[model samples]
Target chain A: MTIRSVAIIGLGLLGGSIGLAIREKLSEVTTTGFDADADVRGRATANGLVGAVCDTAAQAVASADLVILCVPVGAMGDAARGLAGCLKEGAIVSDVGSSKRSVVSALEEALPDAIVIPAHPVAGTERSGPDAGFATLFEGRWCILTPPKNADTDAVSALTLFWQELGATVELMDPDHHDLVLAVTSHIPHLIAYTIVGTASDLEDVTRGEVIKYSAGGFRDFTRIAASDPVMWRDVFLNNRDAVLEMLGRFTEDLTAMQRAIRDGDGDRLLEIFSRTRAIRQAILEQGQDVAKPDFGRGSKEV
Target chain B: MTIRSVAIIGLGLLGGSIGLAIREKLSEVTTTGFDADADVRGRATANGLVGAVCDTAAQAVASADLVILCVPVGAMGDAARGLAGCLKEGAIVSDVGSSKRSVVSALEEALPDAIVIPAHPVAGTERSGPDAGFATLFEGRWCILTPPKNADTDAVSALTLFWQELGATVELMDPDHHDLVLAVTSHIPHLIAYTIVGTASDLEDVTRGEVIKYSAGGFRDFTRIAASDPVMWRDVFLNNRDAVLEMLGRFTEDLTAMQRAIRDGDGDRLLEIFSRTRAIRQAILEQGQDVAKPDFGRGSKEV
Candidate 1:
């Protein structure tokens, strides 16, 4: 069975981007979407994020062969339950949530008879909402799909192809492992970003205006990550608590060690750890995961 | 003196960039430079980083009216001591170290007879070395001048005008205040970035390959910062230990709060803090401190 008609619930950055990508790359497939926010639905329609902006999730899924919930990780269960009453039989259910383990469980419980496969297309900008997405958001990105043990193999293959057609490399992994990997790669990073930004602003010695003015020194990069959709990130942490806590613990330990090294003037230890970390960034750049341009290529374009 | 001739005692990114900037903007000014590494001096000469790359610090400062030390914060004392034997009397001295308090003490102690001023151009990229310097690196950036209380006003004004000529907006700040502000804005952010990248790579459960492949989700941003010059950052943390520790303490407290919120599923707290941080990013962009483009304006355009 091929994914010919698709329904997207929650027309935010991920959902809207998927719709636009489908329209750009797989125009033969009919696309329908609905958002909880009326303003987002209006913007999605105006932007042509999908072929049709339906008034309800049920209406959106009525004639679709594939349904993808793009709501927050914590809201996945509720979003999936909203489609359970009217979803087409044998339709493949999936999501673009960061945490796959909880999302898979939510979809399975909500849509018992449906072919549910949890997937996280590891791509996005700091921006959110219907207007924030672009067709190329997933280009050269990775999409990890986690299917249940007894799920239909053909459905997983079709979904994988759909994402590939949208320009993302696809890989299959266990849902638990997906959660753990994302915790390291995505969840903990956001948490640290949010924490530092909060800390910078809360300082009594440094005025908020001064922090904003001198942010270019290094604080500004973290602000981009901290500026991500609050509700979405909030849900991600809550839904993936175990992995996040685990990663955060390790991060805190390492940070404490760094603080001690600084206090004790252990320059060698500091240099060793800093030097080791540089190799990881090099590897990330080599894999085409990030732009190799200096200062992330944001400033001082070679004159 | 009208500040006609300038000397740079360290030929790293900041030093080389100053040489190139002076050559670009103030073509009439004679600029000479020297580095501890002969290779960097050769590159500085070949790349035209300065008008003349000298073999020794004495040769670099023999005829210059102003001299700027551009070495690691920890190396400022040693680098200054290298110039003590031959530093021309009445030549106003300054440095481009991130931490001002220690650098000021080091310079004042090392060069008692020479007028010493500490200036930090709060700008850089992850890349380093002589080859990493560019003329426009200081353009639209902030250069904070931390002159001693008893310093000559004319010397301060002259240095301020020089940085302004280099295209950076100049501001006068107390060395202690500068260290505190930078601790919040630069030092702690870098420490946090280095810590998170270290934590991510040291994970026993998730393979390093997976972290590198999926870094785009946000981990990659930290890596860019983590990839910064290790020796330089180690010096920064060591020199600014008190302020860094203070800020890190605050950051850890805030991170603990966030961790608790996630563990307890306190969505309201998470959403509140996250939303507040977004406004800071907006302000930073409004102030023109950071590029407003998404993803740090990387990828799509270059690739």
Candidate 2:
């Protein structure tokens, strides 16, 4: 069940990274990539993001044993539909969308004859587009596969092994559960970051210059997250609405309680919550989910 | 008005960094430090965080021309009061608290005769304690000085020069304005981060292990901020109540709008807000407040 050829649809951060990762870690496997944007296609070709930069999505998936749709979740259906008659007879169709439930449904609806195993490699940076990606982007990261009920086991195993070879730890989870987990762990966080960064930008009392200057006080961190791909995030919120809203409700309620504590001068209550959150960070570092160095070691390298 | 001798009242992250920075940049300036906790005092001595780690706050400030209180905002009053009888007649008293108005009042009230020029080095890491300090922590970071009205000009210039010598760019700001500005830039961001991390930890649908495992998706950034010193944050909320609440109200309104957009499937509105926030990140990078590299350059260094 080894993947002989991989096709990446949409040469953005995720797509370009997948192409480059395949070239670097799975050099023996043939890689081809395509983007709707001709400029991106030109850049991808120039950067050698893939072994071949195809003119169309259909051309990319024609010879691929594994076809991964790497566009925004909202565009997954179109991306999948474009490959309807072009994909190899046994091609396993997959995607690297943030949310899994909608993506799985979209791919299944579009590619009725092709095998679809939706996966989300939980890795990214704030930057996007063809030049923003690197070969090592997926290394040491998690890639959750959400195979449909009673799907082909061999196809799933091949995809898992492919991701593993690209330096990712693979996990299998239900599509619904993956959406809910990502809602809390990823979606809501990005939403909150976007909201706060906007809030700071629109302030009447504080100038944008001031916010930018004193950003080291803590605001800079949110700016990085808030700077992530807008179209990708917009589609994420639309596709994972229920889970995102549910997580947002919980976050808003907790934030309300914290606001009340601040207004009421409940130092003890504030201390309790603040104290407990540190343990979660410790666990994250212990599991190697994040680096333990201060300010993500930004001080040493940049400053 | 060259500051010949300086005393640091709390030998934690901010205090210890100040001491080390002084040693590295202004080697001839005598530096003495004291922490309420004897263990921290011992660590300060062992680490050579200052020229002398005094046993008492009074002993630390006896002959110093300047005194900087580096304790939590809630403890600034007591720390200043401890130095009342021992400070030199014309010694300038300052602090490194997040919020400035309350700190200015607390220091002025506790040391009526002292030249109080409260300053906040808008720089730090989540890591705290005596051993967490480093000489370059303030390098190229902003330090806002909120000196009292009619304060000695020479003393203010000397204090500003002192921060500059430590590799920080200093700016003068009104205490109240500083509080309001910091509420958006630091306090509210921290409160939201703490709230989200807490919410994620308490979710029944999402396991803590899952949250940690998938943190790199975006949640881990909030966790780094949430891991900041709890007592310090607790005091920040308590002291900067009005500004934080005001900013929180605006943030809540914006978040509510985003929630409604998601609920109504308004992709255009979501994209607009998400798109605009990227400009702020660009401004932050252009100002040298944050690194231009992706993921704060974490990928190249640690992973």
Candidate 2 residues lying further than 4 Å off, grouped into runs, are A300-303, B299-303
Candidate 1, pairs of clashing residues: none
Task: Please give the lDDT score for candidate 2.
Answer: 0.90
Q: What are the per-residue Cα lDDT tens digits for candidate 1 across B1-303?
A: 578999998898999899989999998899999899999888888889888888989999998889999999889888888888687767899999999999999999998888998899988988899899888888888999999999999999999999999999999999999999999999888888898899888888999999999998899989989989999998888888898888888988998889899889899998999999999999988887877666654554312
The CA root-mean-square deviation of candidate 1, after full C-alpha superposition on the true structure, stands at 1.5
**Chain A: TM-score in each model:** 0.97, 0.98
Compute each candidate's TM-score over C-alphas. Answer: 0.98, 0.98
Top-lDDT structure, candidate number: 2
DockQ of each: 0.77, 0.77
Model 1 alpha-carbon miss at residue B204, Å:
1.3
B1-303, model 2: which lDDT tens digit per residue?
889999999999999989988998898999999999999999999999999998888889989998999999999998888777888888889889999888888888888888899999988999899989889888889899998789899999999999999898999999999999999999988999999999999988789999999998999999999999999999999999999999999999999999999999999999999999999899888888877666655543323
Question: Ignoring the other chain, what TM-score does chain B have in each prediction?
Answer: 0.97, 0.98
